[model samples]
Structures are given as C-alpha cells and as structure tokens.
Target chain A: MSPRRGTRRLRLSDPHRRVRFGLAVVLTVLTIIGGRLVQLQGLDGMKYAAAAEELRLTRLDLPAARGQILDRDGNALAYSVEARAIFADPGMIVAPGRTALALAPLLATSADALMGELTADGRFVYLARGLDPAGAQAIMDLQLAGIGELVEQRREYPAEWTAAQVVGFVGQDDTGLAGIEDQYDDVLTGTPGQLVYEQGRFGLPIPAATHSLEEAVPGSDVQLTLDQDLQFTLEQALAVANENAGVSSAQAVVLDVATGQVLAMGGSPGYNAADPGGVRGDQLANPTVSHVIEPGSVNKMITFAGALEEGLITPETELTVPDNIAVSDIVINDAWGHAPIHFTATGILGKSSNVGTVMLAQQLGNARLEEYLRRFGLGTATGIELPAESNGILLPHEEWSGSQAGTIPFGQGVSMTVLQMASMFQAVANDGVLVPPRIVDQVIGPDGTVIDQPGSEPRRVLEPDTSADLRYMLESVTNEGGTAPLARIDGYRVAGKTGTAQRPNPECRCYAGGGYWATFAGFAPADDPRYVIAISVEQPGGSGGGGVIAAPVFTSIMSFALGDNGVAPTGTPSPEFRLTTDED
Target chain B: MSALPAYDRPQRVAGRRTEPTRVSLQRPVAAPAPAGRAPFVALILFVIGAGLIALLVLNTAIAADSFTERSLSQQIEQLRLQEQELQQEIGAAQAPAALARAAVEQGMVPAGPPGFLIVHPDGTTQVVGEAKPATRPPPPARRN
Candidate 1:
C-alpha cells in the first residue's frame, strides 16, 4: 500500500468500533453481574432469607380468661367484664399543648399534667389505664393521632352482697387479693400470644402482604357450688339474730350432709365484694374457721353419743335430777328449775342437767372422752381448703383432771372453731359419714377444661344406728317444754341441740353472763337429712341461752334453706319417748 | 480534496460523528442512560417487597396486641376466681351454722331463763311469778 494511500486512507475508524466498545462494556457488566450473583445467591441468600423471615413471623402468648364462679343452679355469682385502656405516643401528638387540653377534661385530670406527659420525649405513656370501652371511644374520638387503646378484663360481682364473703375481690393488677380469688388464681389465668411483623424504617405497616398472625387464646370459666337464695336467707337471718340478740355479730352455715358441700355460709356485718375496705380487720377473718369459742350445752350431744355408744344408757335409763348436785367443792345445777325429781337419760338431756352430764362424763373418764372428741375432729383443723384455718383449743390430756371432766361435760374449759362444730354435726346428719368439708367444687382451666376435682373423699365417722338414735333424742329438744322449742319447724321434723355457753371470766376463772355464745346446731326433715344448719349469736345480751337467741335463728334459717332447696318434708314422725317410766 | 462532498470520508459510515453535541456533551458519559423501563420496573419490585414486609409487621403487631389483651384478660379472670374463693371462706368463717357447731363441740348446753317458785313469808312454796322483776314497785312511789 502506498504511503499516500495509507495516510489519506480516511481509515474510517471502523464504525463497528463503537459497537465493539459497547460490547466490551457489556461484557465487563456481565462479569460484574455474575460475580455479584454468586455472592448473593450462593452466600448471602440464607442470611437475607432469615432476615425476611424475621420480619414475617411473630410468636405470641395467648392469654385465657379465668373461670366463672356459678351457683349450684348455674347462676353467675361472679364474672368478668371487658374494659379498655387508653395510652398515648408523645411523638405523634401533633400539638402537645392542644392535645393535653383536649384530653384533660375527658381524662378527669389537669391539663398541665397531661401536657407535661405529652411533651415528654418518651415514645409511649399511659394516659389512662383500665378505662371502659366507652371511655376509650371518647378518647379515640378526639382523633389525636398520638392516642392508643388496649382492651382489658375487669371482674364484676353480680350479687354484690349476696355471697360477699364467698366470692372475694381482686386487686388492680388482677391478682387474687383475698378469698377464693387468691386460692384459684393459677387455674384461672392463661398464656398470652406474641406477634412478629416486618416493619419499615418508619414502623408503618405495608398494605396487603403476607404476614404471620398468632391468635390469642382465651381463659376458662369457673363454676362454684353455692346456692344464692339459701345464702341470702342465711345472711338475713344472721342479721336478725345479731339485732334481736344484742350480739356483736352472728353467723350461719348450711351444708349438704352427704356431700359435705357448703350450700350457704354467711355472717352478720358482711362486707361487700366490690368494696372490701369497709370490713373490719376482725370481721374480715372467717370467724367460723379461725375464731375459737367454748361450745356450751351443745357439747352434751357428744356426751350423749358417748353414753349411747358405750351401751351405758338408753332413752329409758332412769336417774334422779336434784335441783343441784354437789361435786366436791363445786355445786352443779340444772337449767330447768325442777326439784329433786325422777328423770330418764333423755330427760336429763331435755332438762340440760349439768350434774347428769358430769355423771355421764365421769363414767366415760377423761381418756375415753378425749378419744371421742378427737374422733369427732376436735383439736384439729377440718382442712376445708381455705386459708388460715384454726385447729381450735382442745385441752391436752395433761390439762384434764377429775374436776375438769365434770366441768367439761357441761360445756366449759375448751374451745372449738365453728367449722369444726358444723363438721361434727354434719357427721351425725350424714348418717355417720364425716366427709371432709369442701368449699371449692372444682378448679377449671382457662380453656374450659376441668383442672382439678376437689372434695371427693368420704369418711365414715359414726355408726348409722348410733347417729339415728342421737338424731331421735335431739328432736325432743325442740318439742313442747323443751329448751329450744322455738327451734321447731311447723311442717318439718327438726333435730337439734342448743348451746348457751358462758364466756369464762379471765379474772375469776368462772363463766359470766355478760359474754354468752348462744349456739344451735341441727338437721331438718329429721327422717331424711338433706341439709344441716348451724347458727350462733355471740354475747347476746340477756337472751340467756341457745333457745332464746340461737334456736329461733336456726329455725328461721333452716326453714328458709329447706324451702329454697326444694327439700321435701319428711313424712315419718319424729321418734318419741315417755320419761314417766323413770323410777323414783 | 473536493471537501468530501456527499460521501466525504466515506460519510463516516453514517453512524460515526467527529464530535458529540453540546447538549449530549454535558450529559454524563460514564454510562449510558439506563433503559427507560428497567429502573422503574426494579422500583416496582422494591415497592412490592416493602409492602410484603409492612404487611408482615402489621400482622405481627396485631397478633402481639391480641395476645397481650388476652393475657391481661386471663390475669383479670384468675384474680376474680381468687376473690370468689376468699369471699366464700369469709362467709363460711362467719356462718352461724359453724358457730353453733363449735358450741356443740365445746360441750355447751343451752340454758333457758331459769323458772322459779318464790317462797313468800307465809312459809309456803308457791309460784310467785313467770318472769322476774329486778326492781319492786318502789314502796308505792313513796306516797309523794
């Protein structure tokens, strides 16, 4: 090629050179893409996938509702109500001063305080907690972007004062503060759920995308074993007794003899469950289980049982009742003002002869009497599944002496809780089955599952025949001319004993009239015992004995309870005996 | 050179130019303008990814809130059960039935007002009264 031609060869830089350069650049880009692809697809894929998953799924604990407590007929004694809590996001409050001003009046708080809270740099703060749905809605209507609401649960007692002592109340944190609430809290609470969501830098949710959702679980409902009508009757009767007897307080308890289930348990000066602050500290304690009182002549039932079980006496056994019997230095007397007269063993009970009881106790001796008392569940707690039960004051064998025996036979020198007393009578009423008393029926789980079944054990305490004999004799106490005539119910045969225990004087070591515990314990429809009721009026001024104060109260409560429970009348006549056969 | 008239310098192959235009000159030459559809298409994909993430977050938040609410509700319920049990205990403790039972266990026997046959100065035992009078008629009011 000529130089001129080479020089002048407007070597049109090959036009395809630009194409080749673009190709080179494309090739370089492809290499980079391949390398980056290997890094992401081969190595970072798992990491990024994990990050994506982290944003998608959230695990949540689902909380369940506590159990509902219901009556035997499935009436709601206590239940839960839904409420809402109001909160705020300080950052979102567009105008802190204005928001506070708007919320102050509705929140029932000072505007300045609300402003301080809103203006605080905190991300979140509670403006109001535990507000009802309506209150929450009112706050929401303010349309303050910073405001938030959360739904919660609060407790509600329907029959506010009906079963106040039995239903208990809760604290602000929903913890069981007192009563059944404290005992069954674990069974009523449930697990909660958590949620995980992929959030953007601003934390706002992206619309219409797949996300993990964990639905919350609800708690369980509980059912109780209380009878509302019976409870009401018992409370009213106790109030009346307290008023008429001039007693500081009175209490009544009704139980199903066979089942040991407490049907009605109440006392005078009862506290309301919704507001428990009004209850006095002393009254707050369940006096029946914790307070110890010396049972008066009612203890004679034990003496009579001892005498009958030993075959030492029958209803026809004869004894002479003097106006008074001298036992060493002490003189014992009869409540009935009878002259030295002929009487039978049953007559002794009817007349409530302290000397006769002492004679019976002397025959049994301290060892046998103590053994019987122990067998009857004295000197020990009933273990009734309640908090703070007292074992009652049972004099040790060392404390027992010949003189103590005579005195104890007439109901003195010992103390017992009301529960222990009721349980003992329940034993007799149940035809000798001394089943452990039960307050809680069953514990239910949050998911409506039965968690635990309580009170399934039944213990045979006395022979059926012995119990029947005792019942027959007890009925006479409420008959004409008997000490507790007022205890008799018109349409039903009732068997009961009255106790007018003199409160011992700490100074004189003797009982005084100023402090008397008039007590009545019995079972109704005597032939077929369905309910056993016990009542006592403490320090009933001038009422003197169980017949005057306690027996009438028992009659009132027992009749109402029997009728409320639809108990059929006992068709069989109460067993009777004639004491005229006693030899003089 | 005839000024390379119509086919000058082989017309620079019709695609080749001696220099780029001023408007094109100011344009970044490091890389060609991205395809009109690619970046926008990539942006759409990013938006979809973002939306999915947002949905996941929202669902997670809702689930968590529900769980919290349920847990609080359960707490409230348990508290209620405890309250009921306690209340029942209080009732039982205060029940007169229990009190009476306690009396019986303590060997207590009910005592009624004692009846009396008051003996007068005539040396005869006769029933003087059904109920006792603690204070007599105060000597006929002292005949004031």
Candidate 2:
C-alpha cells in the first residue's frame, strides 16, 4: 500500500527536526542527574563518608607491662618479662592430634594434654601461656594455620629461692598469688590501652587510614626494705641450723632496730618462687609471719619488763627461789635443776629460772601480764605488708586456766610468730618504742616520681629507763655463766634470751615429748643496739636447748649481719653480773 | 509609471530574472573584536590540575610513611623484648646463688667473722675481732 500523505511528509524528510528532538531529550536527562548530584554531593556527603569509614575501622586492646619488685638496693627480686602466649582457633585447626604432637616438644607440654585442649569445642583456646621468646618463636615459625601468638608479661623471680616467700609468685593469668605480690596487686597492675585504626578486607591495617592510639601505662615499681645480702645470710643460717640440729624447720629474722625494717627474714625448706607448681601450699606461706610457736623463755623478757615498769622488781631485787614451784596442780622448774638459792632478777633471767620468772609474774599478776603482752604487739596482726600474717594467740586474763598463770609466765601457754618475737625485742632495742615491721620501703611511679612508704609510727610500750634496765638484765643472759653464753659475740656486748618450750601435740592438746622449740631473740652491741636477730629451731633432735641450738645460729647470723652492714662494736665492756647469789 | 531610462535601472543576474528580480541592499557589519585571550581561567585550571597531582603524590608519600612507621614500631617492640631478655640475663648472673657459685669456682669462700676498723675521733684506729680469711679454698679446678 502507498504511504499516507502526512506520514510521508513528516517522516525524516527534514533531518533538523530529529536532531532537535535528540538534543531536548539529552538536556532533560542531564538536568535530572545534576539535581540529584547536588543533593548528594553537597548536602548528604558527610554522613555517607562517615558510615563508610566506620565499616573499615577496628579497635585493638593494648596490654600494659606489670611492675617490678626491687630490693632496698634496687636489685630486682621479682619482675615481669616480655613473653608470648600461644592460642589456637580450634575450629580452624586441622588434625588436632597432629598439631598437638607437633607443638608438644616446643611448648614443653604433653601431647595428650595439648590434644585435649586443641580438640575442645571452642573457637579460641590457649595452647600455652607465658612461653619464652625463643620457644614461642619456634612454634610460630612452624606456620601452623590456626595457631597465633599474643604478647604477654611473665613474672620472674631471678633470685630463685632467696626471699621467695616475700617476693611471692604470679599465676598463669598474671595475677599475684602470694606475698607482696598479692598485697600490692592493684598498685602493680597497670591500665590497659586501646588502638583504633582502619583495616582492609583481609584484616590488615589499611595504609594511611585514620589511626588513634591510647598508650598503655606501665605499673609502678615497688622497693622492699629487705637487704638481699642479709637475706642470703639469714637463709643460709637457717638452713645450717636446720641441718645441724636435725630440726623439722628453722626460721630467722633480722630487723633494723631503728627503723623496724625487715632487713632479712627467711625460713628453711623454702620453695623456689620460679617453680611454684611443685611446692606444698603450706610451704608457700611465709612462716616468719605465719607460723606461731610458744615463745618459751623469750617471753620472760616481757614479764621482767612488766615487773620493771611497774616497779615491782629491779635488776638487783633479791629473791629466794627454789628448784621447782608448784602452782594450781602444775609444777614449773628451771631448764636446769638447781637448789633453793638466793637470786637477783638479773641472775634469774641469766639462769632462765622458770621459778624466778613465775615469782615475778605472780607479783605483776594476770591482769598486768595480759596488758603487757598486748602492749608488746601480741594478739594482733603486726600489720606488715605481707600476706597471711597471723595475729598470734594471746588469751585474755579471764580465759586463763588455773595452771595457765604459772605456765604462761614461763611462756608455755602463749604463742607468737618469729616476727612478733623479734618485734618484741625490737621495742627494747629501739629504746622502749615498738615500731611495726614493714617490708615495702618505696613505690616508684611510671613517670619516675618516687613515693616513699612511711613506716608505722612507733608506740611507747615501756619507759626508756625500763628498757635500759631490761637491756642490762638481758645482757646477763649472754654473760659468762648465762643460759645463752654461746650467744655472746666477741668484742661486743650481746643482749638476748634463750627459750626452749615443748611443742604441743596436735592430736592431744598437751606438750609432746622430745619436741621442743629452741629460740633465741637478741641484739648486738647491747649498749647501742643496731640490729635485732631472732632465730627459732623447731624440734632439735638432740638436746633441744635454745642455748645449744638456737643461740649459735643467732651468733652466726648476727655476726654476719653486723659485719656486712659495717656496724662498729661498742668498745665499752659489759658490766659484771653475779649468776650465783652471795646468800647461797 | 512611465518607462524609465535604461541607464538608471538596477542590473540583475541572468538566472533569478525569471522570478521577480529583487534588488538586494546590504550594509557592512563590523567583525567582532577578536576575543581577549582567557589566560587567567586557563592558569586557574592549570593550577587546579597541578594541585591535584601534588596532592596525589603527597598522599602516596604519607601512605608509604605509615608502613615505615609500622615497621619501626615493630622493631622498637623487638628491641624492648631484647632489652628485657638481657636484663633477665643480668639478673640471673647477679643472683646470690650464681654469684656464690662463681665465687666458689674462683678459689674463694664465704667470708669468716668480719672485723671492724674503728676510727677514733682522736685519729687512732683500732681493729676489733681479728678477721679470719675463709680457710676452705675452692675445690681443685675441674680437669675437664
């Protein structure tokens, strides 16, 4: 069919019409796109950009390094070392048994244990913690697919067994477990930080992406008042005493009499701090602050001091004493059998006469005796900066049994720690002032600012004159015929007491046979005491006398301590004291 | 009208004479003044392009520095670890047991009772308690 007239005329006969229509369509589309572009790019750009950046950002936690424990001379007793912990993504690990076998030797773990950890139903699991750098690096070099490493701090005690009880140890999670570590945990642990940055698709950080870091703050360093040299000496002495006396355990503590700082404190059979896993739980406790034993004749010093303070007796007061005194169905005797004799207070203490001491305690009575015991820091924790300290056992005057008055006077019914016993003598050595023993001396902050730990204030327990008289009387105990003549240090006037008390049987609440606590508490240069040493030997196998077993240990430790610290001896001669009375 | 003189009539070309031969009157239109060179706009565009290129280079440099910074940080961490390890070694060496063992290996023994030299205010020095040397010498050197 022929085309219609209008269609033939309109259809492409004029090319300009087609071009004009195309231009108009192109312009209309461009106008629509330009309007939308203005709305998006100029008005809503920031929000979209922020959302895009947010999807790419990641936050990482930064761990802080734990603090170090230093000795008085800046020796690192305990410190945190950098280490790596190995962890596994159990779901990602293939052949858990094979992987465990491969990692066993490097991790120092058994294959079965590692396999158990690996086959556990969890996304993430720790295979090993606190591995050394070399060991962790070796495992990392294995290129195990699911294994990864995290940097962590491992606590280390370089001195090993030296002062182990005081420095303590940390657990696998870097938490303090005992000793000063547990006591000062908050101060030792630092604040962790955060790292915020953009990461790419494969979890790698995007280069030039926004990054913000809040740096981790390291913990402060704690300085203890312990002198490591003296600590070594004390430990050695205790070890030797234990071996020589065939005792179950031995303990010794040396304190700076003036400052009440624990210069050295230790017990034999100490556990290694680095390898605490195999140690007994009881061995981990610091026995110097925890173990309580009857103070024996050492408690007589308190009785005499109480008597002297109350003006009930003088160093020259004469008394007619018998070999044994019977009081309320119990008979107390001197450590050695002696006749009824005239004795002065000094002679009584020198001889360690239980009869003489009970006579003096009878004059002071139970009320005054209990008050003096409490005043000397008994029946309460000394508030030292150590964990698991015992308050010791000091029964009230009303709680005493009929025979307790007699036995307690001679130190049978009372008990105290070696540290408390040392502190008691410290009061006498420090001129009638009782200063609480302190282990920590200073804490240095991360920014190099030092905070000195103020020691506990001294409390007056006795008059200066009373302490002087006590010192004079105690010196006679180490004199020529005194009970602890072996405790005498040549060229120095020594003042101390000897104590030998039978150990109480746990099964039956009575004194056990052939088990005695031999103890000696004293200070050297008696005229001007510098250091106080207290030594206790438990259950000396043969002749368990404090004078025979504990006194020599004190002499050795005191001599070394004085010599090491360069304390000069007092040149004045010790005054003469009569052990045998003229009326006898 | 009357017949005009042939000399005064306008001249026409041959082909258009068939339709009404219209005389075309034309006035000379001045050509537009040559457009001034827009060098300022060109210079601005050039500056913008150059700035974009400079920014691209600077951004690449910063990215490269970030990688370098990461590498340096890693190296610093390694050095810190090494420092701690060396400190651990020193601490081990200085431990009392190690020192005592070393001293024993070197023909030395623990000190005996230490004597003191007292310096009097009057310039007289007195030695108290004779300082005895440790009689036990170190064990004979190991042959192996």
Runs of candidate 2 exceeding 4 Å displacement? A1-55, A110-113, A200-208, A452-454, A540-543, B1-38, B136-144
lDDT of 1 by residue, B1-144 (tens): 242243333333322433535434453333332368467656777888899999999888886776676689878876765675576556554443444445556655333222345456999865421332223211111001
Stretch of 10 with least lDDT, candidate 1 chain A: A201-210
> Residue A25's C-alpha lDDT in candidate 1?
95
After superposition of all CA atoms, the RMSD between model 2 and the true structure is 10.5
Write model 2 residue lDDT over A378-445, tens digit each, in one string: 99999999998999999999999979999887788888999999999999999999999998999999
State residue B114's C-alpha deviation in candidate 2, in Å: 2.7
Highest lDDT scorer: 2
Off by over 4 Å in 1: A1-62, A87-129, A143-148, A199-217, A325-330, A401-403, A451-456, A504-514, A540-544, A579-584, B1-144
**TM-scores of the candidates in the order shown:** 0.69, 0.86
